[model samples]
Target: MNENKKPTLEICLTPDAVSFIDLTGKIAVIVDIFRATSCMVAGLASGVTHVVPVASVEDALSYKSEGYVTAGERNGEKVEGFDIGNSPFEHMEQEFKKIVMTTTNGTQAIEAVKNTAEQVVIAAFLNLKAVTSYLKSQNKDVVIVCAGWKSRFNAEDSLFAGALALKLKGDFWWEGDEILFSTHSYSSVKNNLSKILKHSSHYKRLKEHGVENDMDFCLEIDKFKNVPILKGNILENLAK
Candidate 1:
């Protein structure tokens, strides 16, 4: 992020990989296409004030005392006792002014780089163009942090990183084989993104959890224009 010329773009495929990536002063776009980030984009675009992303259910539940509507999920299912699940559609409803949410993967990734990155933005296929545009405007070193399943690599998030990287092709200098690998991954399935992604592990896992319907909406591109940028652990729409 301290570079003088055009910024560099890098991809962190999983939370575990964050150890090697220097996010200092960089803009980290957190991608969790299956649901979490999709929900963040959807909620912010729909006029919700802020979405607070917490690392664990305990962290999320603690916010309840302050009147932040609580929402969360674990292993693809809504956590018991929470007011809502991690679904973009549920977020689209906009039942509350603010929310504190946690997810099995996405929130964990957000927590990973919150302290290191200069700015953390939530992203998904739902707001691909918005996120890409925002990053271009920032003109800072970019790290596309894919919230892989449980701190491990997952196809959907990497696919999202690929699509975003492809969009930012001329804006920033690309770095590492991870970016190359993701770009190829996205190009291979771009024509049939939804159909092909239906075979992904997280997709199949959500199906087993009875929330497979969320996948189609999550994959819908450019459905929103707002980019949710994290401010002190709370995400507020940056584009608005």
Candidate 2:
């Protein structure tokens, strides 16, 4: 393959940064390192039937009456009167037939790429390997879109994107600038694993709620082998 013509990998810090990447013909990987992607990996790996990601709390609530189990967080707390919070532990009780999940950043990021990628695959530290394997198999130009904290940049998500970028670096050519295409090595991602808990509102909130372990779980690399791909309104695993 010609060096200039090799398939490329482009990482974006947020969805707003690259709103023009046509999602119809390419794979879009969404990473919300704080917890949504982490919770997604745990939920799917634990056999929760299907996870339906919604952009708004109202949408999630509406789905609740339709037999959809609700799992959501606003700011960082579980939605009031909801079945589960954004934590993976909350969804481990049983196979969630249909979980309406929402969050401040992750959910919106998923929604942002709803019409962009040919398909949206959820990525986190837990499923990084799974996501990378799936992307390599597809052999298409890929975009790693990070769902940063609120609208501002966050280190954890960037590190996760970096990890993916590092994996995709050799096989796929990078299309964006060096900063987007390159990141600290996987070792760096591993080193900063604990920092996600130390530096983010999600960690602080979960710590306050006595769920510090969730952050540790989220930061672990390749703990899960499942890749949650956004299908229609629900997230389903791609057979590896």
Candidate 3:
């Protein structure tokens, strides 16, 4: 480990594993590729003012009481009594002033590291280039935390993490158990991202619920130039 070299990159394949990692000075990029972080990135990129990611439906509802637009999902379906579901396409269809959202994995991952990490940002394929660029500029050790399905590992998030790992390899030394797997995953599906996503567990679940369009929207690479940064408890457009 060269002390003068750029900071190393690591990957935590699931939120449940986050506690074991020391995130004190690292930049944590939360990846929930199936939809949560994707929707957050889309919401901000499509002009949503701020995104408040909550750990549960109760929290989202609480914010809704304060006039926030509530959106979330449970098991890949929209939660009852909410304004919308976890769909980037739905978010892109209209502008929202503020969005309060919760999901099975994504939001939970965000909450897990909010206090420990030096900075937290939401990443998806839509903002891949932007996120990598920001990370490069900061030159900080990065941990790509995948909000796996129900605290378990999932391919989509790991693939995105691997893509980031590959993109940053030139500037950062890759570290962690899943780094090689992630990079391999990225290389295997780089040209056929959507096709590979369609075969993912969460993607199939979303399809059963008739939200394949949302899945399609989420798999698009670099669809937006914006990155969503978590400031305190809110996610604001990094470009702002």
Candidate 4:
């Protein structure tokens, strides 16, 4: 296939992948929509400083004692001994710097394909336009891996992926049908974003946790001009 004809568009709705990404050949967009990526984007935009993605809560704790503000979640709750949990609002603090973060699903999904992809990027609804712009500039095949809750599928991640797909489909050819949830969900949200997440488990989780406002914040698009891409073990702000 020619450059335009190359089979380059693919969306992995869940982090469970049989093959790891070959970063030298493809760009991997990692989505951990139920707030890890959201928090990262928020932290950066809020001027919290650098974010370091870790594989475990223990790893984050190790960094905490070293002055890195620690953040993560397990089963949607903040870890018992961390300075912070996986919430964007929490990172808004001025003390935030070199955040070491892990989460049940988000971080694992990131670690899952970190070694395979040529470039690993973190994505969230908060920086949708920034991510879409970067994806447009790359000629390589694109794979969007949604960090679902545990090994199970969640509506929010796919919905965020759908938004990316809908915008990307006009420019890149897609590979699978199931991953199209992101595109479809994007459309649904566009039509009714306020009500789009009313029934989602993520929304329920937030409401139960008394953080409904953060959910509203996450659903907003293009709030920041900066996109965070993983470079080595840390997240770097991509140029606007």
Candidate 5:
């Protein structure tokens, strides 16, 4: 809480490690770059009122009767009977007031730190600058939680975490093993994100499912000026 001392930056490379991270008094930024967090950013930017991220398809379905649009994916495909998949493009197409979404990794990451973090914000390449700027303004210690693929380490999420760390370097002091790895990973791919990520596991999975366009969209830096911040289980546009 000392203004003169720099806030610290840490990284949780996967949701599996979220349990061990102490999020108390820190601003947790959840990154699921392959799609989920990207879609949440796109959805809010496209005029959706709020997004409720649940841990499973069943949890998302529970909001169906409440007039919430159900969206999510299991194994890189849209869940049967759900309204949409975890594609940012799909999110931008609809103008629903409320959405209940779940995914293999992103939502689980959010749920992991929802109770412990002082504040939770969703981040992706789409709104990178906005997110970093907001975090810098808050002056709180930050924990960047990467929603890795299926509870395992993934390239895209770590890269985003690294990018955030690099951006916050002047305002925060980096800590943790993942932060070091992320910083190097981000620096290596600073010039060519799409090219490097094409070889990633989730990227190939999404490509096989024929949603390469979504991958392209998610990698664009600062595509939206909005930052989605979680409040009481719902993600709302911080820009508003």
Candidate 6:
């Protein structure tokens, strides 16, 4: 890190791009605004103890015998045998001590950078303020990794990366074209996020699965202050 320059921040628009960047020693804020990270923040704030994010349905199901309930979705629908889908409202409704979850894109995104970054923090509009504050406190180079739909770019995650970039511009050196683009785009639609994103790809996918409300809850900015930090294999938040 060049001390003379401001702490650097950039956005990795998809999981496929994760390898091209060096994540070591930097704080990676994982954003999956269409749902996964939003569910995590809501779960912690709603009294769930921990979330174990896995990349496969088999891995998430394996935890059921240990008293960990399974929650997940594939291609926008809940996996047939899981206890719950990846919905922020479900996290708010159910009571659980811990959960193992897998999702179409979010967990895959986590798998990409979990080991490489010095720290990994979950971010969603639900915990936007908390995430920004967490980065500011660490004062390290930052990368907002967006979990785009599958292995391709999606607008919601990119919009979120922009929303986060807007919050951290003062403390970090903007380092990529993605950052510049998201920042400007988010500024124009921040007040109308739901309207701008409605009927979009992820939204329509989730809507077909009857989880329209989940998308609404996921877009609520600053709704929770809990910062779900990945510690070892699970993410836990002690925030009150």
Q: Write the per-residue lDDT of candidate 2 for residues 95-212, one digit (tens) a residue.
A: 5757889998998998888776787899998888878888888877787888887766677777778778888778888766634533754345466568534866656756887777
- By TM-score, the better pick of 1 and 4 is 1
List candidate 4 segments past 4 Å from native. 1-7, 18-24
User: Candidate 2: what lDDT?
Assistant: 0.78
Scored by lDDT, model 3 comes in at: 0.88
lDDT of 1 by residue, 1-240 (tens): 335477999999998898998888888889998889999888888968999999888998999999988998988889999999988878877567889999999889999999999999888888889888888888889998999988889999999899999999987988899999999999999999989988888889889877777888898999888888888978998845
**lDDT by candidate, in order shown:** 0.89, 0.78, 0.88, 0.80, 0.90, 0.88
How many residue pairs clash per model? 0, 4, 0, 8, 0, 0
Question: How many steric overlaps does candidate 5 have?
Answer: 0
RMSD of each: 1.4, 2.4, 1.4, 2.0, 1.4, 1.2
The CA lDDT at 195 in model 3 is: 83
Candidate 3 minimal-lDDT segment of 10 residues: 88-97
Give candidate 1's whole-model lDDT.
Answer: 0.89
Off by over 4 Å in 1: 1-4
Candidate 5 or 1, higher lDDT: 5
lDDT of each residue in 38-140, candidate 5, tens digit only: 9999999998989999998788899999999999998899999999888887788756779999998899889989999999999999999999889999989
lDDT of 6 at 193: 89
Candidate closer to the true structure by TM-score (higher is better), 3 or 6? 6
Model 1 misses residue 119 by how many Å? Answer: 0.5
- Residue 195's lDDT within candidate 5 is 96
3 or 4, greater by TM-score: 3
For candidate 1, give the lDDT of residue 54. 91
